[model samples]
Target: MRVAACLMTLCIPAVSLLAAGCPDTGASYDDFAARYDKINPGTTVASGPSQCETPLGSDMEATGNWLFTLSVKLNPKKAFVLSAAVTAEMQDDGSMLVDMSLQPLSATDQTTPVCGATIEFTDLPVAPDGSFAWVLAPNETPLSLCGEANPISMSEILTGLQIAGTICGPADAPFACGTVTGIVEAPLPDFDLTGSSFTMQKALTDGSFPPPVLNCERAPADF
Candidate 1:
């Protein structure tokens, strides 16, 4: 009888735990699978409240209108120029978050460029120096908003993509502002753009798209 009573006590706690439900950690098997998908290097899962918080900057003062351009030195005509409305905000975790909306000013193929069709990336980090780099490799952090390209072979494309420049300027207002240059490394014989340059600038506007909003929302942890 004593043994059965002890077994019953243990089972009671297990049942209570099951009733309590899973912890609100904002982590799940689906989130893990989506984030670590083998096919897409830049696929991003929408963050839950526990995963990230709303950035600590204003919409108007913290946003800027910018332009981003990319090209391959091997084929100069195969290029794209996009006008981006950018916003940079400091998170409560002391990391900066950058969000951008890019529209193609000129594109070899509008459907298959750096950022695919819509260019909004949630929860991307930025450095204090206003510099960022997005590498196209699997399982890498600090991902760019780049989407899938239309299967341009390494031999045919003949060069690696490159981008470099000041994204968020060193000021407290009107976020992104700086001179940026784009270059495709020449003599890249082995399917690489070893020393290419990329950059961004303020875009000229005649009242086109609406201003971008800071998309991250923060929620306190239940634990």
Candidate 2:
């Protein structure tokens, strides 16, 4: 399982602003555009390259057992929680080396299981204050979409996935990524997180680390 990790101590009072301009998931192209226009009001996706904003906003204590709750716009009822263990060490180079271990806290929504498989950080550069920012922009290779049930075997599902639309972010910084648009298949687009965010809080009551849960139903044996 491949997991993307983020290390930051952010407190976002303006979380609603984070959802603005992100691509719409689980909606048709026309609907996506309409909603995008409604939120942005006269802006265009093709306007230019937008920076991929980090969900990390303000600040909090860095090292702790955190309950990471990822909220997606598509399914508000679904749960996306991960147990995160963060360790920060001061490096000789005057930067902090941060590492995080993240695992599913329970049965998650279809998207969270695969996307939240692992969170790794090795010698990541950080500020003097131990805060960092990062965004997992879409890579050149499209990712395999997973679910609770596979139409066939997980391997088949992975190999057969078609390329879908791009997920965009903020604008005008090395922290962001360039934008691209494309047509996607039906049943809403895959890997869409338009107006979604990962919010984390210290698990004050749960001192024990979160245990790993079972893999998605019909998942590949190795997975």
Candidate 3:
């Protein structure tokens, strides 16, 4: 599993959300991953170039790319912009699904060390209005997405606004990657949120900074 470990102390107000029950109670997280495999089929990402092929935002306006100015405050002094090329499809069950392969982009204009690292979020549901949340796998099976011991769990509180609609927060959800230090128990709501009516300009969450430069061409071919 490729992991992007974010070390930050985030304290989001936890709030309860209504449940979106699973179709089967016996199903496991593995079951969900299998469903995702059916959707994405098979894929392998080739290592990306040391430098991105182009400045990140140049092609954002082009069709098929989803350019979003995000609200992510890493701290009172620093924040990060969120941008990615999104692919969505209708699942057999009628739920709309999405995939976004993550790359490290620089908001500071100065190149950041995270250029070629990869973090992929696969098969999340997409709402009609574009708001979406990862409701987590069923409680019956406790295994990390990477097949390790389950590191964290999502609560109804997290399923509320914190997990909703592309806001970069997941109150109680740790990443699919195994244990991320300092965040093993309660990973920094550390998600790169997505989905908002295709807006390119939005309020700067922490300060003025460009979104990280992404290499969408390097995104996994199957995704």
Candidate 4:
């Protein structure tokens, strides 16, 4: 399988400012916009740059296991509620194919299979702090839209917010060339933490036409 790896980490507080129904100060977006300008730093907006091209396939591979450490503050004193590690197998078809056997650690101390839309190459980007930013969009399914399932995951609620973007790179590049990362935040819900980091180091492999066969026997049978 064609493999390319990217690393990400994000630290966020467990409280929800929006859930409490507070107005946004555009803090997150403003920070992102600042970084975007710093990287692109040009007057004309750098149109038609090779990095903006779509990936050849939908699968995204990883050179090593992707890890995330979440520290939650349960009370005003800032206590540790939980931490987790999620592993994904990059498929040739460009999906962040989940191992299924892997589960998320919980603040509630429950083990649940992490499922849903697969992570894509477009999802990773480098934040200001050099950590990998994992962006998630609100699921638009009938159940989700109807409030049957919460738009954001409970884990995400405890963590920081996610933002989505397009992956761009050379059209003829061997691997799907793009970036991915995450931003860290203070424990306070409404406050924006400065100096968050994101980093990415992709391991590119040769692309094959028919795609290589994946060893998915270890994945959950029901998935």
**lDDT of each prediction vs. the true structure?**
0.32, 0.33, 0.26, 0.25
Clash pairs for candidate 3? 15-157, 105-212, 105-213, 106-212, 166-194
| Overall local distance difference test of candidate 3 | 0.26
What is the C-alpha lDDT profile of model 2 across 85-144, one tens digit per residue? 766565565445556665544333322344334534334334443223322222222222
Best by lDDT: 2
Off by over 4 Å in 2: 1-61, 91-95, 108-117, 124-131, 141-191, 205-223
Q: lDDT tens digits, residues 44-150, model 4? A: 11120123334423223232222222222132111111111223444343344322111232323222223332222222323221122233211110001111111
Q: Who is ahead in lDDT, 3 or 4? A: 3
Give candidate 4 misplaced runs (Cα > 4 Å). 1-31, 35-65, 70-103, 106-134, 137-187, 198-223
Model 4 global lDDT (CA atoms, 0 to 1): 0.25
lDDT of model number 1:
0.32
Candidate 1 to truth, TM? 0.39
Please tell me which model should have the higher lDDT, number 2 or number 3: 2
State TM-scores per candidate. Answer: 0.39, 0.40, 0.33, 0.26
Worst 10 residues of 4 by lDDT: 138-147
Q: Residues 81-148, candidate 3: write the lDDT tens digits.
A: 23444555654543356555433334443223233333344565533322243322232211121111
